[model samples]
Target: MPNKRPITSEDLFKISNVGEAQISPCNGKFVFVKTTIDEDQEYRSHLHFQRFDETSSVQWTFGKVRDHSPCFSPDGKKLAFVSNRSGKSQIWVISTEGGEPQQVTQSKNGASNPVWAPCGTQLLFKTSLKLDQDESVFDQEEKKKEKKKSEPLVVNRLKYKSDGAGFHNETYQQLALINIETNEITELTSGRFSYEPSSWSPDGKSIALSANLTDDADYQIVSDLYLLNVETKELTLLTDHNGVYTNPTWSPDGKTIACFGNEREYLGATINQIYTIDIHTKKKKCITETWDVHITDAAISDMRSGHPNPGPIWSNDGKTLYFTGSENGNTSLYAIDENHEITPIFAEEGHVYGYTFDEDRKFAIIGLSDASNPGDLYKIVLGEKKKTRLTYINEAFLSEVHLSIPEPITAKASDGWEVHGWVMKPHGFEEGKKYPMILEIHGGPHAMYANSFFHELQLLAAQGYVVLYTNPRGSHGYGQKFVNACRGDYGGKDYEDLMAAVDFVLENFDYIDQDRLGVTGGSYGGFMTNWIVGHTNRFKAAVTQRSISNWTSFYGVSDIGYFFTKWEIGACFQEDPEKLWYHSPLRYVKNIETPLLILHGENDYRCPIEQAEQLYIALKHQKKDTMFVRFPESNHELSRSGPPHLRIERLNHIVNWFNEKL
Candidate 1:
């Protein structure tokens, strides 16, 4: 009998920290969404809160509902957030001091990003609306089959498919104002495009928002800031030009608005800088010009609900400003004084997701984490060298496991371009014997793979595979030039950068069996895997998930295909079909010699399943070794937040594929 590889389900349910958390304004209280995998293996999220005084601390709120985005009212007496408690996600409100939450807005459409009005009398939210327009593609196909069939008409602006979220039949999102006192909901903006309600003005008469009502492509090109009048139901565009603007936050006095803007260029070449626009004169000033590193998802990091007007808090008198900044892979909190001098607020080593200040601005509530800690809340006061630990959600769970330390390694690319990467040797690695290796790639030729707690990476290490992954060109965390260098030039320099990372590992690590190398990546990473298999026969096995195989067909099928092809290649498909084909992995499938494993969710809207089908068919036709694994009811987020049983099944499938081939 052959020796079987050992496997267990413990790898499937390890503890993980939730991504987003928010704080309360009126008092010394805070709430965060905590995530965990249940016995059934389903990813569940709930709202967890902590209230403190000199005497004692107490925990509040528990339910099976997936509640998230808990923001308190201006009075700090009530909390508003989104929850799927009623089978569908909706906005709800509850008292922060303890009381049953009342269902605030009940609509068939899902609502998110709930912000309380400055007066505390209303709530502003963004939700997708249904409009009467055209028949669905399915309806059209059905009509062809049954001539007499009657179908319903639908019009949606947000028609683009998302990898994690399936076909959204909801178009343009509109802002809605719900009066807390009257329980009346009024649609604020209605159009073909979408607008995100960012924050309310200080006087509560206007709102600062980012939207694209011009066209469908406008949403993709650039977003601009706008001032929306609540009483008059009028909107005035604030910023002029081709800049991409988002996360518009009103200054405490309502005279100025702060937002993050990006200049649209090639793939991930956008440079996001913090800017403050004067509302009265329409004058804009770039606040963090020198700190030009791209900002991810702008937020008033220092403001919490009910504490003040929930926008950027004016230093009790509106002088100094506090915000989050990221530089060279370090995310820290900083304060910009009235003199525009930037100073580090806290000497910390992890990502800061949120923060809020007290009345005196001397103390702050910060949500932070390091490469080791998943995430925890902390209380930081000025002049204090150490932060006070607040929450301990995953402390007990993480203490039991053996964690891998990912060490950063830099290597020169095939073309002499420098590439940055990190490697994790197998947990409890042995000294002499060579171990199999897995080269993991991150998606978002634009996103950077940080040294953070990744469940899958940890599991691979635990399974005795030395995992080597790199932030190739076009990934953030590096400077703009490095990321932009890959734009309009995919599959060229980026591929070489990845190959260099692998070569660096082989040259540096003595315990790596070069012949037993395996490769895998999702999305763009998946595309690279397909590219690698066709270009080299070195890898023993490969897995491509949610990948793009044929750029020709992909331009028509993928949601962002039309815009993304141009963004990456610098030309639309009509203008440069040859360029798209030249970069496609499907073009070289006949030369692929590695045993390839293809995995994709059945309902992935981002990288449609047809791409997977085309690649699998081509490999099979070429007489190459391959297998296709599809999850029925999953989407792009399957690996991270899919159904419990299915997530485990997906991991088992990956392990099975590599085990058999390697």
Candidate 2:
């Protein structure tokens, strides 16, 4: 590690992301998606295949387009994947022996999420279609028509617009079946509801899926598991309509279905648990009822993309199930038996975001990352602690750079509750040398800051700044009570936890300069930054990105604000305006003394740019030190997946602000 240079913002282009790995049924070959930024600054992803006996992986498909979601046939003779090589995303089929891939579907709206049937003769895919539109219409060629004048967008539903996908249309995600041999297509189900297909029955007579069939789906946020008869088209509801359910996997014998979901006991704060239902008796039992961790990949990092949940994958014998669980600061793989006994398979101090098991369930391909590594695939045996590294995608980049490895730290709140987090020392650090420190907060208020590789944090550490990030009360990975503790108390105990984290770090680490402290976060973290500056002037600088300032107006403008406000803040503007106003950071703007920097995305519908605008203007009117920076055509995910140049610009702005003010 001697004579190595620190990582810079431009190093983002050198990291290659590997995810969505699938092991072939025969256990001889594995395919995964490797994403990299092209010279045009646009993302290019393709399918990569490697044999278990081979020493290196080979690119299966060559293109500048995106090709992902690769699935193998039951016999492992052919591969079906979704690709945009035909101008739009569609299913393509190719033999395992390597040859030209044939286009399977030519739908007008494009097709995705392809799954091979048990017989390997047909494929199940998803497409967008109007409620009354026939499936055949998608197969027809586009006809030229005269251009018309622009029309206004007529809105009726409360959920009209989304963040990444602008406005809502009349189209709904519908399921369909296509025969690969004849290229014949058949529509499965149709209506206003959207169905997400999970697995097919062993006998191939039915399919397990989840959908919200309620009449008022716009208001009622709930989904139920169902069994769709492949031939008869009869739908059978498996769960009550009071909870949210998804990722339904059918048992091998077809007598039971396993899924991950939770009742609305705590609304959006409820943690997901695994459940098994008897198909014949309609009796459901919570398998992971005693397991308190969230049953999904909730780790937040900027170095990963397209990581699937790796839901409950059942063993071939139907006696065991494998899935990923988030706990503490690690997302690990676990297994549950028929007796409801749980065991950790690969519980390491890293993020296992994506994984796949072979047909025999003896080995698995796991995608893992930690503080210093971007990510790579590992092959692990079922009952062993040993693992063999498969892919070294970031080996060359890591060899030339010195990345800070974060040390795990915890702090005790005033109330005696322990808070967990990690601290990254400045690059090229020496003993007895004081350095400026920056407190980095993660969004999701529901998402956890885990042992994952983060480009932003590394860049900050490389800039000679000690970075402190913690999982406060609202973050997942902890038990249910801890995650729900901040629901109704937005800036209450959560704020205390953050302040305590900073105090703990200063007390333990003597090299950190107390006078040169800085704080920055995005989304919910942004809100907390605004709250921190308004309530306390302990930090010399602060940066809030895509943040919320006024809750009353936020409830009307944000995409999920109509219900997210009431669910998180425990109040609505109409019913309890005073309570909502109390949590608004803008209310205490008069007390803010720290130099504040506001960063926002103009097209962000989650925490709209208006939130930043209000905060910047109020601080300006009061003659406070504040500056506003906006990125055009960027959504709420600008920090993670926005344009490459803009993401670098955002990083530069943060580094510059702290260097100048702190």
Candidate 3:
């Protein structure tokens, strides 16, 4: 093979990657979803399998349609997974030895997360059905009638539209079981509320699930755990409080259940911790309470697919537990014993996004991505913490292209808080020459900018821009105190932390051109970019994506706004209108002079397009150099999981804007 050319947005089309691994019951084989873009320019995912003793992997399914969520039966002979080949997503089955897959269900609303029964006689899956309907009567033809009708959307629910899922329908997700032999489907749970089936009990007589059954479910973000009897469909509450909870994994003995959740003491800013509940006494204990670590992995990077929580994987002993978490810009596997002593099992300079353990639970197949690798499977010794590379998904492409190595840097903020960041040098760089720099900020304000592979940053570096990203005070990977710092303070010290990073880079890195500096960010990072340009003209250009410009409107329009505003910004419209304006970037828009490029998603309900609209309108009225590019039909996740061509266009917009201005 010859050396490949520098990576372009189009190069993404040729790349094929794998994720969402599932171990077979025999512990010797595993299956994962290998995703790639076809000629239609749409993402096509197919299942691929590899045995522990095998040297290479074999494709299990062939299709341009998506085939994901692989689940191996108890005996390891049959594999059940969700696929959209027959139309809407539904459960499909195939023999592990190699055979044609059989479509099991034809639910009108579609099915997902198929989990096999303990005896392997049936499979339990989730599907969205009409509120009052009890049978699987909504078939394919009925769906056509519903889709053909030109009816106005009627809404009365407190929460209506979602970003990607779109406007609220009367239907809600419920758990259902399908007998494998008879192909008989039975609705296990039903109500106006939605239910997410997590894990089945050892005996398979009951299942653990989570749902928010509160009167004002939309206003309340917290969910309670429940145990649903497989036979009688009886619901038993496992937890009750004003806190968010999910990912329930049962113990081997079925006496205790391990789960992940947060008390919401500080609301959305609260760190997610691990908990355990006794099935008999119903007593729940916060296992990782005293620990300062955020049990949930919050690392941010572009080279990833879906961030599903691979919840607490219990060892065969059931006394030991393992899970993945983010800390100090790296996400790795961690272990927690019966005594609640947490230890980093596989901490390294990369991101461990997903993993699946063998039947013995001695080893795991890990999905790893870092600065050098896009993503690949690695076999890891759980107890020894040793890693062996299994697959080279992007090795060939990477060997040809020059990927910039981001040198990690650290500095003290204006408030004396330590700020962690990295500076990616230009590709094929000469130490003596100067280069333009771009300060990249990540969203989630609570999300950690980690040592992970990012397509956008690499593209910019390939274009000769020194890209710098940092984990400011509000970002995760740090302790609870640090992550909660920016809450209620919004643009205060958090802004200082980011600026300190830029200052450290300019002062320490001699090759970076000071006058040619630029800044760009998305979501919360976008809010900071808008605020940064408003406050200082230090940067020559700025790009804000899916950003928030007005706190007043963000409080009501966003999906999590009603309470998130009260938690993050400290007030609502009526409680503190003046304070909301005080922190909003729109209020300080008059002071901006930097050439700004506003990138936004029209369907973005998280920040809303109004944020970009108002900012661009204000700048245009003042005759400032500003342009707003709206990506139609895209939500907040336009850069990550949006249309492939549109994602390329977004990258082009960012590169061309900086190339032109900086």
Candidate 4:
């Protein structure tokens, strides 16, 4: 490791991310997606197959196109996956013995999320379709000619636009059945609502799916599980329609269904819990009601893509269920029995983003990542602690770089609340040299900063800056109370917790330069950075990306602003305009003395560009040191999934600003 160079921003192109791993029914083979950046700066992914006993993996699918969501048939003789090779994403099937792949569906909008039936003769998939649109509209060339001119978007619902997906169309996601032998397609359910298929029953006569069938879908914000009779097309509601439920898995006996969801007891801050519902009685019980950890993978990282949240996979015997849980800065696999006895399976200090159990339950193929490694697939034998590394996707690139491994640290807030986080030392650290430190914050006040590989953090550490990132109140992996503690108190105790983290690190680590401290974050973290600069000038420099400066404007502009404001801030702008203005960082911009840099996405609907414009103008009017940078054709996900060149440019801006000020 001594001769290896520090990680560079350009190294982001070299990292390969593994996800959607699935073990074949025979347990001898597994398939996963390996995503990499092409020379054109676009993402390319394909399927990879590997035998359990073999050391090298075979590239199963060939193309520069994206292929993912690999699913095996009941007999494991054929594999089904989704690919955009045909200009639009559609389901494709290939023999396990290797042959030419056959296109199964050719709908106008294309098909995805293919689930093979128990009989293996049919597959269920979802596709976007306009109301009353027929599946026969598959002539792409004809449709292209029929395309109409741009028209003004007439909006009626509150959820009209999204960050990644822009304005809403009339299309709704609908489920359909396709016979692989004859290539015959049949529409199953169609309406204004969208349906997501989960699993097929053992007898292949019924399918379990989730959808919000309520009249007011935009305002209700709750999905319920349902049973769809394959032949009759009769839908039966499973849940009480009071809470959000999804990822329904049928037991082997087909009598009970397991799902992950929770009631809106805490609104958006509610913790996900596992529940079991009897297929006949419609009786539901929360199996993980007493569990303190979140049942979903809330780990945030820029290196991962297309990783799924497959809730509560059932064992072969149906008496036990397996799932991934987030707890204490790690996402690990867990097992639970009918009596609610929990046991840790793969509880290593890393992120277990995806996993799939073989048909016999003999082993599981897990996709895991740590602080130093990007990610890879490993095979873990059931009821054992040992695991065999199956794929070395990023091993070669990892060997060429000296990545910093984060050390876990804890701090006590002013109110005696303990905050948790990690710190990464500079790449080539000398014992006596004082290094500048930068405080990095994560978005989704609800998401956790786990033990996963973050390219941005590594790049910062490589540039001779000690990177400090912490999970203040409102972060996941903690209990429900701790996560909900920051609601309506965004700048109150949460700010104290972050400041305490800096104090704790400075008191413990002597090599950090206190005067050269800098702070930066995005979304919620961006709001925190603005708040930090306005309230205190402890930091010498700050960079806020895709941030929120004014809560009043944010409440009306953001895609989720209307409801999210009341849910997270405890009040709507109509109810208390003064309170919303009080939390607005722009209102106190006059007090900021730190050199501020604002980076925003031009098309970001989550935190609109106006938020950054307001802050930049206010600071400029007051003659404060400030700079504004905007990236066009980008959204809220600019940092993680934006264009390759822009992402690097954004990183370069941050590093340059800190290098100049710190």
Candidate 5:
């Protein structure tokens, strides 16, 4: 046999990935952002250029600073992208061919979502600011940072802190335009509200956007589409429904606008659907309302490749729309025609995370990831489903590594619901040898685990553990009622469904050692791991990462606590503390006999460290075999997007704990 090695964190860093593919308008050449970790342990994403007809790709941008979101000009002469080479992220314009990039905007807070105006000489981008604050106010704030004194944040809004971006007193992302030739920047919309620029109108005089301009904006998840006039500074509202509207792509004739949103029928757990609006008549209709799939991008598997919200990609004729949605545990690209019939475009069995097409939308540049691969770019012919692999960013690593491909497993719940999952046997497995197994759960409680590449799962399998991950009821891509089943019943059927899955795997797979079984998960998965240990203690060892142990404390401290608690559990601490305790894993901590490893991030705002703190204290007080490993300067996304070194350490911690306890 050829010499091969198990995949490691350092090997994963060697696997450079690509995303945000943009096809140049001038020549139909492709330019995308390639992301990788350098020796210094910082993420470096730079633009790279390639011709679809060519066999190789070449680097376009260099250095350690991150560069991404490549958008070609209308004429395709230059490309606009957000880069932080000069300290803060700003829009930079570079030639289609190799050339020095020109800094177009100098926004203090930074600029993103760069879209070239139809006029080509101007562009629209997004920037955030303090409420009722102007550019000069932020300029003064930047000068204050130069003095090197950390200022105290005074927060007043109910939704003052976000998971990734913390402690925003009063900030709103607004749209603006800049004249490239003259370096003159024009603010498009201003107010206490934030504006997300979706698409500029064909005439370049108006732009489509979404914003919630309400006093209870934090409570209200819905936003209305507003058409802003570039010259008059006038705003016209379109589709004022009780749903969040975003990413409005204008039709070629400018008669309609396609947007991705949902009526939020299930509150926080609602699967987003595609909707279209008549710009002239102000009439709106949900196109994918009955489709029973999440219209937004749910294809999340890699921390290296950032998840860009998939769109209602409009064909040049506007008669058809293409988008990425989850179905049958896989997130792939699909299309909807004028007859209201939906069809799969590049709908194979994989995670189609991001895709970009030309003005005509006849062909597309796609980014996909599978069980054995990280991610790569491909070219797809819209009508024929012809795919041409464009770049193999992880070829070298995958070629040299021995990765186990997962086998699909299905089990019917006691309530007759079908649960879809996969099982990955350990590498170098020998026949008739019993191996220790692990039950893996996904986060989001709303997110699905699909036929995509997962680094952690593969790493666990490499360490001689059979990894099993499934998409339970609360996960997206499994239809409306099924995805909504876990809501108001967190530890009830969701718990049963997981146990049934494990029972099914153990019964069918003889090679799995039932006595040496282990369980681990993060986020909602973390909560389930905690729940599993506290409820039954069937697993010999368990590792819970960034988890929620107490719901009462979770309802107040978590970023999404205010709304998520009432939405998921159907009750709150203020309403009924008993209901919270009934589902909280901490409530049954006295029964936990399984050795539990609690992994938490100190800076995790969504599931605060206090959740882990309470669980650890309770377990220790009860003399339970429990250990809490706190990762400082890390957030909830530590597994996927945190510092590279810390991520390796986390993996090492999990492996060490499992190896020691199991």
Candidate 6:
């Protein structure tokens, strides 16, 4: 292969996407954010609105401003959103019918996830509380004095390292109530940690939110549902126990609150189920189980879907709730009646990540995607069952690009457990020639890899390689047992599943060169790649990103380390360090023969840099084949949400390494 042109930052930024979905209170109108690149190579996003009658969609907010999280007033007269039009992100409001959006609150720190109060006289949102200015002189003097000594840099946890947005302040996101009449803002909840405000009761007496208020354990940041009395400012914890709880939506009458979250298990997998809590009794019931399916993953990329929460829409009478799930391959919308009987509202072969219902429930605004399309918006008219395209947002951009389709394939593990995988044959593949193959693994071992569109996998296929990605044990879309089976058994059966996937591909795809096989993955996928390289030299090369090499060391560094380690390994660090060491891939580092590439973000609290450093140092000490790549200003989310330039650079590096070594 010939050396390609050096990668540039502009190439990376060009691949970023802009997506937002909002609804009007009257269910008569809808709004969504449209993002694009300008002539100056700057990204811009704005709000667009469309009436239920399809009176034509029109851009609402203007200028070079990037506005998102649009919500309509109860009276359907005003719209609220977060915009940086004034040089900094602030809350603003505008009329739904027409008129300039009015700036609500101004602050150097940004405000986000705005929600209209039921009374329409006020709005509730979260804003970062700014810290005092930092004195760089003191830090410089300290560095100079310590130049001769080897001392570790100490940072304040509250004002620690941030990504493209620079260092953070001693700030935490707090719930704020803004009076639309006087533009006065009142802080409701304040603390070192942040609170995600989801919704307000229909009567505006209480605000429902999710936060990690109790149990100061460093590793467990799982949020639980809470209700704050608006008048007294009293906070009440609603749901308890080990599971993560968020996305609280108030029932029409304010008697019950609906939220989505997952329960932690002994295995690495989590059961993301939907629950309904009775405010009066504080009793909870898992509503999703009635359908025999779970709302495992929610697809909203913005805080608008209420981060870490279930973005559920209540029926007109408030007797039913509707959410999205993947029970039969593709994601679909399911409705749970008041009686708790769940049934599919709509099922399609394509993916339906989420839906926004109009006030009347007559129309549903949805975000959808297929094997070919990354994402698109649709208006599904109830009763009539008509699907209308709201915007051809990415058509013009994607039309010029060549995309590949994912072909489903089956593999059987050594234990005879059937594994599911998707293979992307090299684009423009030659019929008779054998091509190098790359096995891609997904993170969350619990997360499934379906026949959906994958940008990275497709790019590799386009570059002339057969990309094979699989969802072994612990992956979703399968039942609970298959996923939980991987618990306390890290490199065991799950590893065998991956090996079977590779063998199945080699046997079914005759054109694949067995000698030129490679593997790469991020997080859990990265963990598996590490295990594979150590256990067998089948792969000619490998790239592990933000991966864990040693379970013992990993149990101390990651954000979810304590609970996560115990859950996955079936024992806490103090109880069974030996078991953790036994499952750790780094334990067999000396046995690894394949050349390896290690990548990690400098500030990944989930899987800290030390994990990568340990592997790199071990391999280098052994004088084995290896290389390490580090992203200075990145977190565990580098692969998905890092700066455009860095993400592309990261991908290119993987491609470069595999191209040269395989």
TM-score, one value per model: 0.89, 0.98, 0.97, 0.98, 0.97, 0.88
All-Cα superposition RMSD per candidate: 5.8, 1.5, 1.7, 1.5, 1.7, 5.5
lDDT of 1 by residue, 185-252 (tens): 88788756678788888898998888765555534566788999999989898887467787777766
lDDT of 6 at 251: 86
User: Per-residue lDDT of 483-553 in model 3, one digit per residue for the tens?
Assistant: 99999898899999988988998899999999999999999999999999999999999999999999998
lDDT of 6 by residue, 275-387 (tens): 88899999999876644454844221211122222377788798888887765356777777878877766676666765777777877777777666666678877655467
lDDT of 4 at 229: 98
User: Residue 309 error for model 3, in Å?
Assistant: 2.1
Better of 2 and 5 by lDDT: 2
Better of 1 and 5 by lDDT: 5
Runs in model 2 lying further than 4 Å from the true structure: 131-137, 141-148
Q: Count clashing residue pairs per candidate.
A: 8, 0, 0, 0, 0, 3
C-alpha RMSD (angstroms) for model 3: 1.7
Q: Which pairs of residues clash in candidate 3, taking residues 3 or more apart in a chain or in different chains?
A: none
Per-residue lDDT over 1-662 for candidate 5, one digit per residue giving the tens place of the 0 to 100 score: 13778777566577777788888885548898888899898899998899877878888889989999888888888899999997889999998766799888878788899988999999899988876455521242154344666768876778889888877768778888888889787888777788888788998889998888766887787788889999998999897657788888888898898898877888878888888899889899988777888876665575553566646778877789888888887878888999889988888888888888876677888888889778889888877857889887877777789888999999889988889999998978888999999999888888888888888888888899999888889988888888889999998899989998999999999999999989999989999999999889679999999999999999999998988888898898999999999999999898899999999999999999999999999999989888989998899889988878888889998988889977
Per-residue accuracy of model 2 over 86-111 as CA lDDT, tens digit each: 88888999898899888988888888
Instruction: Please write out the lDDT profile of model 4 over residues 552-610, one tens digit for every residue.
Output: 99989999998888888888899997888888898898899999999999999999999
